[model samples]
Target: MKILVFCGFIFFLAIFPLSGAGFELKTVIDQVSRQVVVPAAPQRVIALAPSITEIIFALEQENRLKGVTAYSDFPKKALKLPKVGSYVYLDLERIVSLKPDLCIAIKDGNPKEAVDKLESIGIPVYAVNPKNIETVINTVVEIGGLLNASKKADALAKNMRHRIKRVEALIAKTDLRPGIFFQIGIAPIVSVGTDTFIHELIIKAGGRNLAEGPVSYPRFSREQVLALAPDIIIITSMARSVVFEQVKAEWNKWPNMPAVKTGRIFLEDSNLFDRPTPRLVDGLELLLKLIHPELINEANKCL
Candidate 1:
């Protein structure tokens, strides 16, 4: 199996000199609460998740990124970097071949075995777990600290906080919480629940998530969705425009549904809604516009 070969290669590397031996070392607690000994100034770093790649780029520390996992296609320039495979299925051999001084990982997406194997081979792997918008901002600051770009990180966090407060200020004007059904999966009719970033965005953007529950992502039947009578329906997709149009057409069949009657169904970029990056603030703003267009329109008139 590929996993077996990867483990064997890791074992082979473990007997050699530690990779970060000559560097200045510092002990710090990662976001996952694990104490890791990392280089005082890591020069060659590998980002284990797309979100991590975006964060590094946002902090203007992309020069230090030696590698990134696949699908880190944001910022356009990241497409030129070497890939260490997908976040869920990491290519440990390729990662080791990059000769990185550090590896930044995501606790939610990166496989635990891969982290353990990389650490076992004496590679410092600092992991971050950003569960919400606030933690995501903290993640930016923490990663900035690691990369020695603290000032940029602080400025970025301040900007995000300021934008969030502006949204809150506008939302305070109205108590209307439109019922929203956000579709992420087309075939299965999947929607996010309370624990997900999408749910938090929906709630914070002054929309009520009809799928709010214990389940992270819940599937819906056509009848069930019809029963919810959502005021707005937003679909997140990376598919072709035709596919989205087709999906929209399917939803448009129910004339009696509130969303269908008002023509409030919309399609959104999946990355903005799902990724835990600085752009999540953009997602929140987008949601607010869709959910409370009246408020935004009114605010614009005052300008």
Candidate 2:
């Protein structure tokens, strides 16, 4: 009986560690499907999006970042990191060579096949989808928790929330709300509708999106745009040398449009406005300044 009991005890001991091995679980957003992501925290991390890279830096996990996408230019130091190619077209071989324990990617920007390939090769991938400013804050906190930087993430999230709340409070007190049209891309005449982060920013910045007919980004006819009669037109400042004067010259062709007639067209930093990151507040402040110039001083106070 003693011998049998001793064998059983040994077996129990053999399995005990396996049974109780602690594994951290983290919730994130899957950019492709635009859903919540819950994955194990990765140690050797590679970020596939510039916005994600910014969030990682904000979380102070720069040392953990092994690789970043080609376009991650902010923080200046990120430019020195290993390039994993663009999110849309990643260099799989380079990524594989990096031997990252875990990879972070935007589900929309990073192909699902690439994520699957990495997983097949025994690498973990966390997909992030921050669709709005609030979601951006939550994503930061979640990523921080996953990366063992929960305290910093919490602090960042709190600060972001406070800033957003302050904006909301100020907007609530004002009776004036401008109708805004956000141009996503110009050549094809793409505009953000209700389903995009930019759309959320428009609302947060105390403006109503005039591109309400479409649920997502859509290319509309110039006549349709003119009919919308937006009070303000916000062109994303992309490409080298944003020429508001050139844009205004084009808008002048549509003499009857409110945005054109009132000369409420403005250009905003595309990186800040389009990328869902901590700097979105800066984009909001910019919009607020354009909509209500008087509030610039107060917005600066909130910042």
Candidate 3:
């Protein structure tokens, strides 16, 4: 689906033709939903998702950023940016008031109605779907091409790929794959199923996900989780330490569980594991180390 465009303006500066950086940029295609044009040197940009904001900052295009959705605070400077709304639902009026030339979004996170409304208003919205680890990697490259920062994007994508490969190499040398339970939500005991980025990363990080439900995020009962017999339990919560610890303590009641008996439960930074950004690599490294303590030293190398 790669189309060649005139990169006459970008060709001479930091030329990265492979990532489609130069005088030309390609249209963003999202699951047959919409095609968006990337304006050359877009003046005002609005990021509708945290991950999109991180990508823009990674490419050092924060200056072009005029507005962002709630919780788009990765690069310290972003905190000062104006907020249009949360990724869950945007303040259309506020976003339009920003007068951005381009608005970035996530197909899964942003409401289609909102994106369509923005498009109708003549503001270009480029939405990407990072459904899996591979698509997450591709996002960095694609975003870089759109911002004319192909070189930086290529390097970032290469680094993530290299780190992921390192984990895979370590996993290949191991025969024992631990069964892991990733607890994301406390109420109703929610966890990621096979249809999620976390699930894919768990498999790639040399572990088996115990919660294999139908949806991306599935609700599990206490008895159901106990039957799974997970070897390890990992918690990812954006809540305060007190709240997160309390959530972990809830699992403590099941002392007979293999994970509880072995004290294999771990608390991870929610920002790393929860976000579909470059930090997913960080999350994967930690996951690998937790699953195989023997790879603790090897995990550092991947990061």
Q: What does candidate 1's lDDT look like per residue over 163-281, in tens digits?
A: 99999999999999999999999998999999999999998899999999999999999999999999999998888597789998999888999999999999989899889999999
What TM-score does prediction 3 earn?
0.86
RMSD of each: 1.9, 9.7, 8.9
Tens digits of per-residue lDDT, candidate 2, 168-238, equal 77788788888888886777787877877777777887888888655688887877788888888988755
Which portions of model 3 miss their true places by more than 4 Å? 1-33, 298-303
By lDDT, rank the candidates, best first: 1, 3, 2
- TM-score per candidate: 0.95, 0.81, 0.86
- Off by more than 4 A, model 1: 1-19
Tens-place lDDT per residue, model 3, 66-157, is 99989987988899999988998898777766667778888787998988766654567888888777788888888787777899999999
Between 2 and 3, whose lDDT is larger?
Answer: 3
Count clashing pairs, candidate 3. Answer: 4
Lowest-sum lDDT 10-residue window in model 3: 1-10
> How much lDDT does candidate 1 score?
0.93
Output the worst ten-in-a-row residue range by lDDT, candidate 1: 12-21
In terms of lDDT, model 3 sits at 0.80
Candidate 3 all-Cα RMSD: 8.9
Residue 215, candidate 3: C-alpha displacement in angstroms: 1.9
